[model samples]
Target: MKRRIQINIAGRVQGVGFRPTVYRHATAAGLAGFVTNTPAGVLVEAEGEDAALAAFSALLKAQPPVQARVETFAVSDVPLRGDTAFVIAPSQGSGDLLIGIPPDLAMCSDCARDIRDTANRRHGYAFTNCTCCGPRYTIVRALPYDRAQTSMAAFTLCPACQQEYTSPADRRFDAQPNACAACGPALRLLDKQNMPVPDVADPLAAAVDLLRQGRVLALKSLGGYHLCCDATDAAAIRRLRERKHRPTKPFAVMFPSLEQIRAHCEVSPEEEAALADPSAPIVILRRRADSALPAEISPDTHDLGAFLPYTPLHLLLLDRTGPLIMTSGNQSEEPLAVDESELTQLLGTFADFALVHNRPIVRRCDDSVLKLSGGRRILIRRARGFVPGAIPLPMRGPPVLALGGDLKNVFALTRQQQAILSPHIGNLAEFASYSFLKTAVADLARLLQIKPEIVAHDLHPDYASTQFAKEFPAHTHIAVQHHHAHIVAGMVEHNLRGPVLGIALDGMGYGTDGTLWGGEVLLADLCTFHRVAHFKAARLPGGDEATRHPVRTAWSQLVAEFGDEAEAVAAEFLPALTEIERGTLRTMIQQGVRSPWTTSAGRLFDAVAALLGFQGEVTFEGEAAIHLQMLAATAPLPPYPFELVRQRDPWVISFGPTLRAIVQDLRAGTPPAAIAGRFHRTVAAALVETCAALRMRYARHEVVLTGGVMQNDFLLDLLHTGLQARGFKVHSHALVPPNDGGIALGQAAVALAKFFT
Candidate 1:
């Protein structure tokens, strides 16, 4: 008997060769059907033998394209029509935009083969791609993800390329970026002054030669420009660092192959998988003790950020040169350079020459960074191949947009039951980053055709993201507490309904009591949070300057612990401070002027780092903490003592005793590594004790660990074990970062729950 059915499928369906897959499946099954793209999803109608039709339906679900992720599929029976042949019909652009477009994928293996195959027409082509892989999110400017709606529209397909694109059976069918070297975006070699290198014959080869000669080259990449230099050359690395004003923060490296990277760093199977994945993020891998890479690549860190070449241009360049320092093409804390003219102007001082391409980048995205935690990839910076993808919400609500915290800024826009997070927009402290945030958010909203009804932002009024949220006239404007957002983001990532005991630990967040909070234990759900217990507050003298100089934080902590006697301790322990600076800080701490108290886990780490003589001043945001974690002893140590002062309902875990013990250890000639390890253990113990007590009182066994402090692998691993052993189902971030970079997800989730409930 003949049978007919209509199917509507959604989620990561468009631009992923779904219709072509369906067409081939139906034809193979001997079913007459038509498949077309609708705004909601892919729509298919089939009429054939009932057995064949059932098989076709199963194939649609089971044999989807590798890149496609089917979220929702619906099927309904219909009266059979007298259709005799299978056909891929024209798309119907009638319904409102509903489905998510897929992020850009790294170049596929087939394309790589073609690029390397001498007999292939696209031999040595830098932009060779098929339907399987190529630029998607970066080049896309509008919806329906067709070639006409992308940056590739400017470059009309050549005759031969057009034939492959039009052929339904070809791999390049409907491949928006399909192009041969003869009629594709062209590459050029330009000097720092933006003039073409007159003597250069082959631009890529010249760029490679320049890199080998220790000259920095700013190469235009898939999403933005990357300032490249020979990673093995210490002089070149030092020069690049000086030019960019980046002193000690680790720079990411791009090796040609997995074997090459494995030679320098220890790559576990999980880390190797992430490095080779299509998203192609910079995976943080532990360095081999006997490795020979230049120390300047990753100073004061045990791990090296490494990734394989994702683009053909990168592969071509790597084929010519060894590992290159593939850092973002921008000054420290600035937005990454995207436009050719703007990049040339900004990177003039940083690079000797520019290896640029003519293809326009519709949206600027930095490469994502990942680290393995408990054998799972944890996103440190979610960008590039991961951006603009929808994260399913726990519940549906009115459209809401969340402007994340100022640091590690990322925003989210919710539609239906999914929240689409924008790529990592770095610290909003810089005007350029703030501007990029605005433009990127606006572009995403426009491209996705969404106008949010509710706007969510941090409670901190001083945050640039909060100020941006104030400008949204159409939104309801809800202020979510910073640490609450951190905890909730973890819950949202795990898809857990909370009322969980959330341990929010980070550098700084605006507390509900008009103070800064980073070490917080909260009874939290999606809609609200209650501060149950917290670390003892310490003064932050000189405001933001305290973060740069850990010595100031140490003095403040000492003063809070030992009164006037702190002046002597400061003089003896903190030799990095000038006598006058010490005197001024003591007076500030005593007078409590321009000194805000913070119960920050980050500040405690900073104080311990300073007292142990690790680093008094840091070049990056979490340098001291990172170095402290790096210097810990391999074996476990007995934790330092901490006082749980329950003088009030919301108790305080006083680190005064711990600080004093650390000072005693410093004087008693204890090894820095031992002290560091003990300090870490002490912190983990305090948090575990707090959560165990909370579970006993509240009877909630679900414990969520989140915030920037959770980025420390030692602390996270310890906490994970301790909580689970105590019969608690511990949840921490896996998909997104535990840092402020992922707070936007929590903000969006909270806003949705608040508005709808």
Candidate 2:
């Protein structure tokens, strides 16, 4: 029988103790072998009795380490050579670098146990991690994931720890971040002036006590710093809000455990699984009606963004502080602070104390945000435990870079059958966010060793990302239409090819025709898309000004429907509107002066929310729409009337009937909640009917629902359920965000298709 075999394993093998596991299994099978990490992937050579080798191979495939994900394992025969023992050879950097980089993982159970055990050497160690888990993407400076190439290079292992590193039986075998408290990074408490605090018996306890005192603390984490305070303290929460300049934006909380989370909010099985998973992200859970959480925590919202501790430091702090407001460690619209100097400089004025750590965070990845859709997790903002992890492409193409849209910006770099999207970089309207965008792109390219031949960007020239794309020298820059990218992203995410109906719904996008587009129906594939239908055009008085003040948009809609009679009705609905502002808005809409026409579904929600007297001026991007969706009742209601008129090539879906019905309901003294519920159902029914009509003409049943408006779980649930009931194959985003955060993936995928197909 054959006695020798060589195997090549790819995908998430380098940083996950894969080679050590392979060596142990081979030795147990009495096989003389050696395994090593290569630039491409992991390589192993085994020589032993045929049966023993067979068992070894089976073990490698079936019983790999918990963190090791073997996507491709290939075996080939090799000539037998007598060898003494199995060994994990030193990693080789030579080869074409095509390996998948592992994202930062949560601390494993073993590490957590060691950190908690009183007798263990690593007891109370905040950065305790084994080979199976810990920072990877955040600590990594280059490929071949060795300690020498990471931020941990500065911390050498102690003698006793070195024994664990060399022992195959030990959990810390070949652990890149392996170290004891004597040699590894240490925590220190610093005042606002960046000087270490005096006479601190325990820094962690001191930090917790500070938090208990309702003081804002800037605490260092694996990826970056976080501004933290007691979540239940209303005064402290209000102070943080004022300091961060984040008036109405909801803050994410870090609870100690699943039991504690269940105590506050309604957590479904799906949400529980997500919270308990290795990549512990912030899961937005629906708060219980009787929840005792302070109103200031979520302020006018039904859902709370909650996450379990992903690190030992967080665990320790949470053990002392029941729950903490753990938000990004930066001012509003700026990139998250990573370095100590940067954190101190940016947060010193606000944070009462800085809980600093010496463990350098190479990359600044913010906490990821997600929620459930149809019993499955949907990412809102992909970061921290999920960044730099490549999404498999349908096919390989020339390397390309795609700069996403203005809001919720995320860029992507494409390579052979994979697209690695950047973490959420906020809006590019701010200089700091724009700067982060540039650094993220360059850092991704450098780390992955990608030289992009083609660049992709949005069609809008005014977008900062679009402008950034143009600055890339010697690259072919392709401008993808904003809505087209939104639709195609859903297609690429689901690995769909050929034609599918795409319902692109969001706030606004730069249309190919130059008018603002949001609500759109398109026939899309990887290469291109064709707009088939859209919402009827309505003037956005004062353009972007109409977005912040929903009353102006409501006035625009009312003027579109009732003309002069709209003023009297508008006065009744929007009591906050000043007559002078109302008159000016009316004149702007009538004269069409700087009033850009838009077919935006988001605007419709804004108008409806304004009509229902929910919000006059939005404090956040989707504040009014989010409030409207939350106010909607679970009981199903009959949809309001809407018209699908085929007056032009692409039929216009008019909201005139819906607006008129809403006006009547408001005059009839209907509850705003009832109107909101009916409005949501109406939008869903209208979209479903439009899809049915499109199906009759195109005969395509698969519809991909995408865009920022799809973030509304109420509308998404209704639309997804209604569309599926009509015998249609529906696809919505789960891996990437439905918002512009996912636009880069679509852009990159399209560019690859155009070049290769």
Candidate 3:
């Protein structure tokens, strides 16, 4: 009984050796057919005995290529074509674009071995790559991912490389980026002035020597450039920080192996798995107390962002230098440098020399970042190794484009039931980052060939994303409220269509009433939400200046609690503030000059931190709060007392009692660590109590925790444990970030739901 079948497969099926795997299995099973890449996915037509065909299908299901993810597989019987042998067919460009674009992958073990073997032809080759691992999203210029459509199109394959590429059994067969030293892109060493370094026998070795000498090198990577320096050299790390103008923010360190990482950071099983996963993201881990790494790498925190080498260039450099600080090559708050011009313009003063390659990066992507909270891996930044892969929507909807919030921006495009989020686009406040956002939106839309019917953006009218949405051509435009989007983002991740009790906590979001909102509780579904409960509001004196200097916010909190006595309390707790500064701040609070009220849990953390002896303005977002968390980690104190004023429609969780207790503790000479721990415990307790009450009133046992403040692992763990103990289902972010980076997904989901409604 000879028969034929046509199989259509979707997902990450192209540019990952899927065709070769199919060819080998079909030949082994004695089937005659062809496998070709199509706009929709991979299509295979096989003609053979029923038994052989069944075996082939089973093998494909059981053993897909290492990097291939089969999301959908359909097989149907077709009339037999009496072909003599199996063959790989050319890709088809017409049809619906449904296939997943492969993200940039880390170097595979086989490729690593090939680059290290002395006798291997690819030995010491900086651009060595195979089907399993190499640049994908960054180099791809168009779809039906063939070599001719990629950055590799410029490099004509040499004879030996072409033989391997044409051989069906070879791993390099049809691999778009497949190349050897003779034909592939090569590296070049240049000075700060962009002139080539002459007489360099081995560029990689010279680069390593420069690192050992504590010189900063701007090195091109799979996605973008990284400014590199030896991690152990305090002077070098300090110099790099000074040159880059990044004073206090932690830097990601790339180690040669997991063994090296284990020596400096406390690697749990979950953290170890994430560090070695195929995506190879930078995993945040707690540094060991006895670690010998220089403090300049990560200041004011116990955690270190560490990762294994994801590229041969990084591997080669780290093999000689034990560890290197691999921070993004960009000026402060700008997008990552992706080309020579960008490198020189952004990192010219910072980098002593540039180690660059001839291959052009079609797109710029930063490294993805992750951390474990309550044994669940959470994405801090989604890019590079984990982007351009679609996340399944709860239901199908029309194509929609969502422009995310202004900070930690990431955009999303919806196709039927799938949502494709763009890689991390830095703060949209900077001109370079904003330009990158526009470019990324256009690039992703063109690649997916999606013409969005609806455009979604944040409710903030002043955001660049919102402004762009106003001008983007679409049939419909939606304005999604900031906190509402945060809650819905968590619901989308969990595939929930519920009126869940949502706790949205962050620094600031424009409220519906034109005030600032952050600590909010809402009864929300996909489309709409009702304000249920919220934190008591406090005046933010000096507007944005109060955020930069937490002491001003602390003074405002004191005034809210003790009125005129706040000045005397400020003298005792905030000695850093001068008497004149205090008098001026009082006038600001009294006259409501440049002051706005906010219900922000983030601002509360800053106030408490200031009261606990933290001084001076913060250098980065969440710096004061992060310092408080570090202090809290050292103590295990019970929660301070809090009050829930339930007389209003939307009840208020007041921190007046808690603030008074914190002041009393300071007066009693209690350790700052104890006060910090108590403050954290108080916040967790108040949130749990509010949720339990809301669950009883609304009969909704499901609770969602989201927002940038939820990134605090310590608070998340407590909230999760407390809610679960009270017999409620608790959901937190795992797939996408809980910060504004994940806002686009929520915006898209809400817009689609509203469209159907």
Candidate 4:
């Protein structure tokens, strides 16, 4: 009797060697089956003895490609016509299998073996790849993940590759990225204007040599561009800094391997595991004092963000005996260059040469960010290795699009509780950024087959992303408050339904009551959040200007404390406002030209940084705050002081005492380093006291500390230690950044909580 079974399998079935693996198993079991890709998933009709059929099915469920994920399976009887031998057929391209585009994978064992093997056809091949590993989402243009639908379409498979691709028994039987030296994407070394450098056999080696000799090379990478230079060369690094106009904010480093990175930084077991994961994201680990990288690479920073190679090209480039400063190749505050036109224009002055490639990157995703928390390593920005992929939501519901915040902006599209946040798209202000966001979102929607009915965005109207969301006329627009989104984001990442005390601090956000809020203590659930506590609101002379210029913020604080009529104001302000033109400072605060009130911890850190004279002028966002914490280098933390004042019968953290003590220390000529240490310690202590007091009232020790300000290592370390000593379980971002960039996930989570449970 001829027997047949129809099997439907779903989940990361595309671009991950799935069909080939299954075909190989079925054919070896002597089952006659035809496999085809449908929009919903893979569909197969197999006819064989019950025993062989069962065995093939078992192997499929138990062992498939390592990178592939199987979410569900359905099996049913189907009438069989006498069919001989299993055969993998062409994709049927039916059904909307919306869920399973594979995330870009790191180099697999097979590819790694080939890289290290001198006799292998792909020996030392920079673009070597297999079905199980290599760029998937980054290289993909359209769906079905066929070679014709990818950036690799330009390179036709050679005779050997074609044979292997056509044979079910071959490892690359269904590999879409299958290519050899004779046929595949090849690397090209380009001169200053992106002209191909003629006659170079090992361009990677030559590029490394140029870098070792102190020349900057702008290398096109798996995602976008990277500004590469020897990490150990300070002069070379400084030259990069001058060229890129980036004076701090700690650049990311790319180590050759996990072992080398571990030797440079103290990697926890979890961090090591994440580093070795296929994604190979940039994981922030505590820096070892003896690390070989120059101090300027991460000046005044305690932890160094590092990663191993995700691409074979990176592996080939890093085969040398050292790490490279793999910083983003762009001028400050611009999106990374992906197109050749932009490369020549944006990175023109920065790099002397451009490593070019013919492959087209339809979308650009930066390498993901990561951190270790509570003995676990988790993703911060889920990109490169983890985009176009969906996070499981708590409940199933209608589709929604969440346009996240302005800084580090990433958006999400949701179907049910599952939200697929696009990989870090960028600031959302630049024209290129807006276009990237629009195109990537549309691609994700097309792949997932989702049509959003509700659109979520931050409350600020000026946000470029928010404005973009309004263009979606069909969706019901919903504006999520900045801190509310922050709190809900913490709740979503922690998988909590009950209310939790969330401390959402950042540079600035519009409060519901029409004032600026940064330092906020909120008792929040996914549904709503109550403003429970906050930092004292101080005057700012021109709101945005005050943030960029911290001296004005510090001076405004003094004016708030002593009023404009008070005497000795100059002497008191002079200690913190060193080098600020005194006449102009007093006039701005008194006349209130740009003076508005703000209660932002991020701004407070800026003011403290300015007061310590670490930085009076900020060229970029977060510069002042970054330098302020760096001043804590070796300063012994002094006694931190703060008072809980009743503002309209609600508790508020008063910076008056904090400011007074800082002034007293400055008048006495205390070391700026000590002042920085004291201020950080003081703020951390205040947070502990405030949150603990709230904890006593609410009976919840689980406090979530989020927002961009928490990225400050000094503040994070102090707050984590202070709160732990005081007996509170603290939760910070691990799965997502604690910054505005991660706001979309929270918005989706919050919206789902309302729409679902």
Ranking by lDDT: 3, 1, 2, 4
Best by lDDT: 3
Question: Over 4 Å off in model 3, which ranges?
Answer: 1-11, 25-63, 69-86, 89-100, 634-636
Structural RMSD, model 3:
2.6
Q: For candidate 2, lDDT tens digit of each residue in 1-757?
A: 6578999998777667787788778878888879988867899999988899889999899988777667899999988887778888877766545353578888777777888789998898888888888888889889777799999998888998889888976778978888778888889999888889999989999998899999999989878889999998999999999988888889998998889899999999889988877678999998988888888888879799999888888887898899999988886767888986687675566798998888889988988999996775678899877787778888888889999999999999988788889988988998989999988888989988899999999999899998899998635889998888988888887889959999999999999899999999998888888888999889999998889988888888988898778879878888878788888888888898999999999998999888887655687789989988888886888999999987677888888999999899889998889999998998888889999999999999999999999999888999889999999999999889999999999998888778775
**Better by lDDT, candidate 4 or 2:** 2
Model 1: how far is 405 from its true place, Å?
1.2
Name the regions of candidate 2 deviating beyond 4 angstroms. Answer: 1-11, 24-64, 69-84, 89-100
Question: Candidate 4: misplaced stretches above 4 Å?
Answer: 1-98, 373-380, 562-580, 631-639, 647-649, 665-678, 695-702, 717-730, 751-757
Between which residue pairs do clashes occur in model 1? none
lDDT of each: 0.87, 0.87, 0.89, 0.78
RMSD of each: 2.6, 2.6, 2.6, 4.6
**Per-residue lDDT for 182-265 in model 1, tens only?**
788988998878889997878988888899999999889988889999999999999998998888899999999899999999
Give the per-residue lDDT of model 3 (tens digit) for 334-424.
8888987888864468899989999999998999998997787678899988888788888898899999999899999999898999998
Over 586-638, each residue of candidate 4 has an lDDT whose tens digit, in order, gives 67767866667788998888777766774346776777887876677535566
Q: Which regions of candidate 1 fall more than 4 Å away from where they truly are?
A: 1-13, 21-66, 69-84, 91-100, 564-568
Question: What total of clashing residue pairs does each candidate reach?
Answer: 0, 0, 0, 11
Clashing residue pairs for model 3: none
Candidate 4 weakest lDDT stretch, 10 residues = 565-574
